[model samples]
Target: MQGILVSILVGLCTGVGALPFLFIKKVPQALKDGLLGFASGIMVFASSFNLIQPALKDGNLLSVIGGIIIGTMILTFIEHLIPHTHTKNYDENDDSSVLKKNILLAIAVAIHNVPEGFAIGVGYGTGNVSTGLSLALAIGVQNIPEGLVVAAPLIEGGYPRGKALLFSFLTGIGEPIAAAIGFFAARLTDKLLPFILSIAAGAMFYVVSHELIPESHCNNNEMLATYGFIIGLILMIIFRTVIGE
Candidate 1:
């Protein structure tokens, strides 16, 4: 129970991290794209290096691959269900509905966060504190852009700064809900653990490749975004190795 609470608090911190956006009048497009790209790189590297390789070491390559495919398919299915919209810069001729765009962005970010929190909760429940913390912090860091993604549209939509920021912050609450579910499920059945963790790894990989990478390209220099991504991966490796997660 304590572990679950801790996980929820950790997840909630991701939402709190968005508080700063309430004061920003305008955010730079290039900055958003660059950060998003960097995050994508981190997610990809983490999935491959940390998640997939570890599963392979456990002699579960088939499950790992299946998990990846399943995760990717889930995202693809969701994308088909609801078309995502980007928050474009305000222009005289633009017809974008800011509210609709932000809402969609929130949903997309929430989808990604659910798997992340699950990974964290499962890690902690199974006595893998280092792994859980690393995953949570990494996922949280990556979520900053998600907050911005939500905030930009709300701000553009003419909402008060506070309301926009509040909306952005609220979108990330799914992480804790995921954590609670994962932790409780693991407590109920240990055999299901590997599948859940692998599924999360797969989902995160899908999100990075399908969503974050493309968003990065849209808002920043591709080369710089790529550089940031590499840095994110390296940092993840360093943390994992040094912390022995």
Candidate 2:
């Protein structure tokens, strides 16, 4: 129960980070690209260092490898089934582009957050306070920048500040639900947990490559995007090295 609460708290950071966009009307293009790149970096590093590594330690290497393949394929299938629209499909100058991007981004983030929330709960359930809180803190740190990534476009695209933030908040709710589920699942079956963790890693890797990175580079600010990705990657690597170890 305590671990579940902590996981929910970590999930709530999504809303807290998004609170800033409530007053802002526009975001700079360079900043937007940077934020996207940063998010991509975080997801990539977190998936590789935190999720996959831990799975390898806990389970057979073959099962973990299979989970990774299956996870990536699952997300890929979802991508095609959804057929979501995005800013690139419409003119950036168009008024509706921002809303479109936000819609798709929110959906993707929400789906991913469930696994992340579960991971946090499982960390605590399977180990101790230190394990749980460390996972929570890492997700919480990433959520701060993610809030910026989700809200910036909506504000510029004519969404009222409140509405944009509301969308972000709603997506964050996935964490608590998954966290509770994870806590229970880990306790019920030891064999399943490792594969689930690896699946999460693969799903996140797909998102970073297919979604966030592409979105960042879509604009002319490729250089800023690259710089942001590198910085974010370094930060997450260091963060994982310290906390996830």
Candidate 3:
């Protein structure tokens, strides 16, 4: 019960992040690049250490590899079926295009969030609420930047502040929902934990490599972005050490 509550509270950080955009007029491109790079680093670290490494410990190498490959393929299928564009290309004059890009990014973030929620749920389902709380706390803190990532661009692209924040909030709702589902799923198939974890890591890897990295380095602040990535990577490690089991 406590674990579930913590997860919801952590998820709420998404809204906290959007609160800043409500008062700000414009988001600098360098800041955006740095934020994106930070996110990418966190993703890479979490996917590799927190997720995939555990799978390697518990599951056969082949199964873990297969899970990763299949996960990547699933995201690839989504990419083709629904195109995603950066905030830059779409003109503010074209409301439809701007909205489309916003929606796409929202969906992408939502998809990426599912596995994280599941991991939290799995922690609770496994009767380790302490670890779940730690994981949720880390995710919640990370979601702050994600909220900025989601809402800032929409503001720049012409969406009303309230509407942009709403969209960002929507992306976060996926976490609690997925958390519930993950708890149930984990209880039913505890033995399959490693495979499931591996798959989620793979999906995250795809997101970082395909979306976050390119977006961060797309502009002139490439070095700043790299520095941001290092900081994020270190943060993730520290997060795991301090709060995680």
Q: Each model's TM-score?
A: 0.86, 0.86, 0.86
Q: Per-residue CA lDDT of candidate 2, range 1-245, in tens?
A: 88778777777777776787756667687887887787677667767766777788889899899988987898888888765654467766655665566677878777767767877777766665665676677677767667776777777666788887887777778888878876787777778878877876777677778777777887787888888888878886676567646
Where model 1 places Cα greater than 4 Å from the true spot, the runs are: 13-17, 86-92, 188-191
Q: Please identify model 2 stretches exceeding 4 Å from their true place.
A: 93-98, 241-244
- For model 2, what is the alpha-carbon lDDT of residue 138? 66
Give the best candidate by lDDT.
3
Provide the lowest-lDDT 10-residue window in model 1: 86-95
2 versus 3: better lDDT goes to: 3
Candidate 3, which ten residues in sequence have the lowest lDDT sum?
A: 126-135
Compose the digit string of candidate 1's lDDT tens values, residues 59-98: 3767777777776777788788977855444242444554
Task: For candidate 2, list the clashing residue pairs, or say none.
Answer: none
Clashes of each: 0, 0, 0
**Model 3: CA > 4 A from native:** 1-3, 88-96
lDDT (tens digit, per residue) of candidate 3 on 1-245:
55556667767777777888867957787987888888778778766876677678878898789878977997788788877876567676787877787788878777767767766676566565664665576577667777887888788776789888888887877777777876776578767877776776677788888888877776778998999889988998887887655
Which pairs of residues have clashing backbones in candidate 1?
none
Model 3 residue 203 CA deviation (Å) reads 1.5
Candidate 3 RMSD to the correct structure: 2.5
